[model samples]
Target: MADKCHMCLLGLIILCPLLTGMNGAETTHVFCSSGENVHLPCNIALSGCTSTTWNYNRHSSAVEMVSGGKKKNDIERHERLSLGSDCSLNIKNTKEDYGSYSCIQYVNGQQQGTDAHVHLHVLHGQCFCKSHV
Candidate 1:
């Protein structure tokens, strides 16, 4: 009985740090209006964007927007996409850009850290008209 209790206590101590580190990787929410420009932030900050990659997922499939610090021109919305100096993914005139954006970092062709997730919510503006008699 004594040996079992000792092993359980040791296991908790070793797993505590690993569980705490998982909290650092969290999802961020960004809200924007239609026809407006928006930037999705990356949680991890590195020296340069040479190892950064951005992907967008609207419903099922994910499309790569920026890879290796360069924008992919073959994408549908390539003209409206740009990468910021700090590895952020920027979109111009966001109309159908409401989706999930992920920022991943790599080094030496291998992924370095966990992916940073950003959820974009697009809100359309409404107009209210009043009539006076």
Candidate 2:
């Protein structure tokens, strides 16, 4: 019984930080196929995306994809990106879109709350075809 309790406590200590950011924001994992469209949720309730900003990072410096609910025209993949009604970041025809995305909300030029982090994992799907002889 003591061993089980200790193991549980150890697990919590090891996993808690990974589950939540330092600011106590929960991280969500989104998995999608390589060539499919994907939605990275903001997980925040808001009337509009006017105060939302989405940043993406893939093993390097973060890039701002959307600012104040508007897509950044200068971004590399801006053509394939759109902001959903619910402030979710939508990426169309996702091929190399796997990365860490963060949604931040600001009001009056100040951050409102904790940022929502999302880790996107893109999997290469395989097709199996059978021949009828």
- Which 10-residue window in model 2 sums to the lowest lDDT? 124-133
User: What TM-score would every model get versus the actual structure?
Assistant: 0.74, 0.76
Off by more than 4 A, model 2: 1-24, 127-133
Which 10 consecutive positions of candidate 1 have the poorest summed lDDT? 124-133
In candidate 1, which residue pairs clash? none
TM-score of 1: 0.74
Writing each residue's lDDT as its tens digit, candidate 1 over 15-37 gives: 54454334465666666557888
Model 2 lDDT tens row, 25-129: 567766655778787889873788999999999888899999999999998899999999999998998888888899999999999778888877665653211
Against the hidden true structure, what lDDT does model 2 obtain? 0.77
Q: Against the true structure, whose TM-score is highest?
A: 2
Report the C-alpha displacement of residue 42, candidate 1, in angstroms. Answer: 1.0
Q: Per model, how many backbone clashes are there?
A: 0, 0
